[model samples]
Target: MEAAPAVLTFSPSSSSPAGPRPCRVLAGPAPRRARALAAPHPPRAVASSRAPLVVSSPPPPPAASGTPATTPAHAKVDRSGRFCSPRAARELALMISYAACLEGADVVRLFDRRISARREPGYVFDKACLLSYNHMSFGGGPLEVGTEEEAEKLTSQNEMDSANEAEVLSAPPKLVYNSFVLRLTRELLVAVASGWNKHVDILDKIIPQTWKDEPVARILELCILHIAMAEMTSKGTPHKVVINEAVDLAKRFCDGGAPRVINGCLRTFVKDHVDNTGTSQAAESKA
Candidate 1:
């Protein structure tokens, strides 16, 4: 007998496998949403089941197309063929922090003809005190607040050099503690008080932590330890060892100014420390 007019039928997949049986449909175009489905009635079966309620998911949202977001750029000093180590980055930041504090002392030196002609670097204590708010530092306010009273106190001390060693002004009064090593420089202390506020912002933007664990806080601690070591070692005359130690320490801990700073701080510190000791030893020791 001739085959009865064949009704449209769907067949199971040819490669032998166990799965849901096939469904047959008249050959025609899939409906709008049906175009996405593996088979026509699967969702209907799921909906019918008393065992659990189920629903088919809609398609995912498309991604937005555009330029990517801006991010902070860190300066990486190359170490041989490779990028700097985390230790190096930390050192660099610390050096920057140190300089930023004192660089304010050169607030006058920082500018040249363009600015100098306009006005003398203001001698106003407001400018110095304002550096307690270094644009680049970790902290915002100067560790030493720059109130009129504070400035007057420091100015008075500077004038009274002959009365007593105690009376000699040690530092301008507005100077505060270094956030990292906590000794003191009139310039540096102001810088640090400024840095204490700015540090977080700087690290967050440019210096990503070396690891999840090795954060800026750790770098700061290491810097402090190295500075402390430099201070203790500089007690001897010559201070070359003091400078060396400072450099070595900065390399291991801080991120920026290991070399030049070691030189400056050692020279100044040796002169002060030795002179205070009232020793002729400095000349011989330096030689």
Candidate 2:
């Protein structure tokens, strides 16, 4: 067969083929090993598993008509773009008091400028009462709860001090306009500062962990509740209304869960201080 097939020989130094030209060897152990090594390793399979369970808060209450409430025309917008609802005279009062405490501005001057210009400003008598409360508790000066008649005395005394010469007191407190609301707010401020320890005691008993763990975070909530509980002590408004207003305020200024915490604290306060006899147990004790 065309001169017997040449037997193939292998040598490292040889460069040419030694077998017949037409014959070829394609399946060899060395080539198989090379192909196996060159091939990519397949990806390993991971076991399937379910995601971890998570506890979530309940959904928020539904809106009345799925529309956001509009701000009242009387609401005052401060330099910082903070709007206080016209009905939020109490909030405005506290804001001024806090400003007085932190900014070192005279309480009288701040009230004259900020609260005086409101659409339905609180009674000057109530303002004087607030000034007296601020002085005694924060200012550490004196406490003098003024009567309705003292409204005139307060006006005449501050007449020369104010630019609005027509009105004896620049911001004369309203007589019938939200009187209960103003009284509630003023009393709250007074009770909070004057009875600071008592409120703290109530908070300590109700939510001790909050006071101990996150005192700073809960400061606003505590202040709101302090005022709410103070308002409750007067017996002029129902407990539910006080709690609702406190929760609403917390929702506005505080982070999530604040409203719930406030509600809890206020409910506890009501349980302890309010009686079915339609009287404030706390007030009766004071009397």
In order of appearance, the predictions have TM-scores of 0.19, 0.43
**Residues 211-235, model 2: lDDT tens digits:** 4454533444555665676566644
User: What TM value does model 1 have?
Assistant: 0.19
Which ten contiguous residues of candidate 1 have the minimum total lDDT?
Answer: 37-46
51-129 per-residue lDDT for model 1 (tens digits)? 2322222112224578564221222223221123332222333443323222222211221211223333653222222
lDDT of 1: 0.29
Candidate 2: which pairs clash? 122-173, 123-173, 123-174, 124-173
